[model samples]
Target chain A: MTDVDPIALAVFLFFFLLVTVLGFLAAKWRRGDTLDSLDEWGLGGRGFGTFIAWFLIGGDIYTAYTFIAVPALLYAGSVVGFFAVPYTIVLYPIIFIFLPRLWSVSHRHGYVTPADFIRGRFDSRPLALAVAVTGILATMPYIALQLVGIQVVLEVMGIGGAEDASWFVKDIPLFLAFAILAAYTYASGLRAPALIAFVKDTLIYLVIIVAVFYLPTQLGGWDSIFAAASDSFDAFNTENADAIAAGEVSGKGAIPPGAAHWAYASLALGSALALFMYPHSLTGVLATKNRSVIRRNAALLPAYSFLLGLLALLGFAAIAAGITVDNPQQAVPALFESQFPGWFAGIAFAAIAIGALVPAAIMSIAAANLWTRNVYKAFLKPDATPAQEAKQSKLMSLLVKFGALFFVLGLPLELAINLQLLGGVWILQTFPAIVFGLYTRWFHRHALFAGWAVGMIYGTWTAYNVPAVGDPDSHFGSPVATVPFLDIDIYIALTAFVFNVLVALAGTLLLNAMNVDGGGDLTSPDDYKADAGDVGVKDLPLDEMAPGEVAKGTP
Target chain B: MPDSTRGSRNTRPVWLLVALLLAVAIAVPLLVPLYDRATPTFLGFPFFYWFQFMLIPIASVLTYTAFKLSQAATRHDRAARGQKPPAGERGGVS
Candidate 1:
């Protein structure tokens, strides 16, 4: 702990405290009629305009883990890590086509979560329950990954876990950070992240712009950086040739020819499809005021992707700067500490720590929303009022945050990473129910459920069977697997998603032929086009009833 | 209802254009082997690195154009129906 730089620690603490105060103050920043409703607490009163929604969703999607890990992946692997850039680029256009429809319909019916939309669209509580449970489960590992991001920054700063310190003393910093985050999030719900997002994005853009332009010059410029990176990788590949020949280690440097190409493409496509399905991403989209905000932000949000490209280059710059750490995850922070002054490194570290705060807050809120709306209210207490729902969500938000904390502390970081990878694989299974159901009701409810189950089972089984190149005993070692019978390696998530869609299609036809009723559709095609201020839309219960009064809100 | 009908009809061409742009966006990046190389460097960055970076703004511009075209089509439909455009629609550009 004494190895931590005073200036950096001080600056980090300063920004952390500032955001904590902002988080508490956020409860009143955008005051609604009352705090006794899910709309106010869970979705920030559902009135965020384009600018705020841009910051919120941007801050949510481009998370702290991404800031740390994408570059870390580049540091560890080569061009394969660049998969993130394309995955993010393609995501906006794909979401551009569907998310506006989601926003319109969700807004029309005051739907609070994607599961809410699923329930309404499919008219099946059981199907919606599956989507909700998957969302909560997938989001837990993501929230834990954000904590890992903070821990990496702390470890680089030398205040993380000491080699010989007791576990309690070593993890005090992580616990402290999580405590403030949990307190503020419990106090303000989605508003905490919504307000803090502005600060997080500002710090991130400032740090990235400075690092992108300044770091390259400090090293021997971009050409030297690229040369140094290439030289290192070339040496590495040559050194590992015997191991590569024996398939003891994976090949290095960019996506190699042949099957690696399929791996890269499928990972990109599968991730793009899965990105918005995460409950946290939908939480951001649901917070916007109108349909056009979603569209407008889709256009503007690519600015972050451009920034991310610049950030990914920092990995090469780290290699060129001759900064080395035991963990590739520490590469960026190590680069900043070695190259920049202590004060600037502190600012960069604060940008990342605060970065973790924004998403962790949103993810917990999202998970809590799922629990309150889908699990608790749907199962335990169908008669729960809005006030009761908000109360349960706030409590569950705290529980979810701490659950992620326990996850980071209890599991090996490798296993945590594996779980997060599995999160992506799991969340994509819900796409057929949520995304496809937005456009049509052709898929039978039972068929969608069966598809989700099959996708989950196949994805997990195949992912579990994949062994690390050097360690055959290590299961779930990679997101890519053989495409089964095709004998080409592709992203396991995409393969499972293909199976998901097929089973759904076949089952729908079979179920329809058997004359199984596909349940009722509550939303009309016009509902998908209903924007804010549209006439005769379903009125939000909050607007119709007095605050704190129990109203029978439409499911 | 008639406004929405007109809105969909007028935006059909714009949607088709958007679909084409999106197709190109997905295809160029998925065809990884085409630009997955060390040569053809720009500003000292490899072709693999620079080509993907270049796609960011292209995607952004295409998306923005589609958004504007769709909005304009919707506004035209609303005007034809003698309804004023939504208030939030006007101030977004600035």
Candidate 2:
């Protein structure tokens, strides 16, 4: 293979070093602030305003998952792939509805993680542990997905490794990048990602805007781009008509055909419901200055969806530009390389790599927060000091990253993607406990725990049975499956969610009949309405909590 | 125990309207059959493509409107509870 281009490598390394320096310096972003507690390290002192909160959340949402995963769908001609656009549009409104209550209650109770919120709200340590373990397990593959995004960009630049390079050598760049990220996140906590988000997002928006408006012009125009994509799909379908008839492959299309209508809609609805259920997404909300900041961001963040909608279409732009690659994930990066100059293309590559880092940092931190708050404090050391808790979170963040690195280095990428699909399903199983607890305490903790367990098993089993197309023996092939009796294809997560709610409802009714004592509610109604200046709504870290403070604050 | 009875005490019609606005914004885009067409093209864009892009602004305006309504409703709720109005409503940091 040819050596990597000197000019592009220089430019990419320049921005990479710049972001590394910025990440290390972010330990001091807030002057005189000490990284001594979960509140400061895990949630960035819980003081980010509307602007910084917007970038941080945007950094999480507009991630490699957005830039790479979404476009690769359209490039590969998956009809249901465009479901991502509607998925995001539906997400903000859901956020506008439920997230404020979560923020308010979390502020009132010194909760550093969602599991902490569950422990306080439901007072069931076992149920909270269930939630915490699910969050950590689900997030590990998500972080690996981000590493895949960066690896794709590096491969396009020819810096990752040559075609036949050894696996360890092929992944050295990712290892170096993750090492720096782990170090800075340990030092500054959430603040490192929160600060670097400002740079990463700006570069990303510039690259997308330039590529969206400029690429179509270079490849004829939007009309021809659409036409070219449609024509390409038609030719592919004709060539593979025999395989399509045998169900060995899915048909290529620009939009959902009649049968896929439910698949598209259910995917949108299901992902919208699952998005906020992710611990990393909530880490952004809890870090905001107050409840209003979350609402304001919910409204303002749709601007990124508009940008994302445009970016997803770059897959079609690749078609019209005649950019072809065996792996569809390589199309967009290869587009930037062939279409843009060496220098600007290097800048774009750097942006994508850095973009992946933001969510990777946030996801590991969220997972670590769960381990420290729910598993460690709840079970091992009931009276662990705040300093000790922060130390635990920092170390756990490293361990979590190493676990994700195992997924990247030790396993195949497709297996990781399939597990990430299940991750979405498993995380959504916590919705009954979390979102319901935000509104009412009616659902018994035991009932919710049972629902989570049932949903997780059913979802995993169903997802495991869906055979891969073109190879009828493999499983975890798709996220959608046919409904049992209704016989329409829909997202497996939504179906599992329906089962979860029904089981929780029936179990709660039975428990209420028996008068089985729900441990106790540690929160009051006012806790859901409290804000920054409200009584007992102090923004103190858990380590700062004095003895009997939780007991005293309950009323 | 005292706060448990006040679930609806601070509730306002604006809050109801906020929920309505957000619900519509969320549900309208998920109704795939409504705009899943390629016949009508705008600026060389299919109806399916442009319509979803258009929903972005339509949803934004609705959500922005909901943001303001919630801000006002929250102020009224705080005032009713004998507390100061929430900060950061007028671009002020908390």
Per residue, candidate 1 scores C-alpha lDDT tens digits across A478-511 of 7788887897888888888899999999999999
Best by TM-score: 2
Candidate 2 runs further than 4 Å off? A1-3, A25-60, A160-191, A383-391, A406-420, A540-555, B1-12, B89-94
Distance from true position, residue A109, model 1, in Å?
Answer: 2.0
Residue pairs in steric clash, candidate 1?
Answer: none
Q: What local distance difference test score does each model get? A: 0.73, 0.76
lDDT of 2 by residue, A1-555 (tens): 235777777898898778767866764655466544324333432454546544544554566777777787888898987887898788888888888888889888888577888999999988999998988887786787777777777778876666578967877667766775676556655555545556776787778779888888988889999999999999999999999998888899998988999999988888788777776666556656677877876777787787788888988888888888766777788888888888998898888887777667667776787787778988999899989998888788888888777766644343223445656778889998999999999998899999999888888898888877876776677888998889799888888888999999999999999999988888999889878777888664542221100110000
- DockQ (C-alpha based) per candidate is 0.55, 0.63
Stretches of candidate 1 off by over 4 Å are A25-62, A162-180, A187-190, A385-391, A402-419, A538-555, B1-14, B72-94
Task: Give residue A84's lDDT in candidate 2 (0 to 100).
Answer: 78
For residues B11-87, write the lDDT of model 1, one tens digit per residue: 56656776787677767878887887778889988888888889888888888887776677667655665655743
Model 2 lDDT tens row, B1-94? 1232343365567788898999899989988899889979998888899999999989989999998878777776776777776756434432
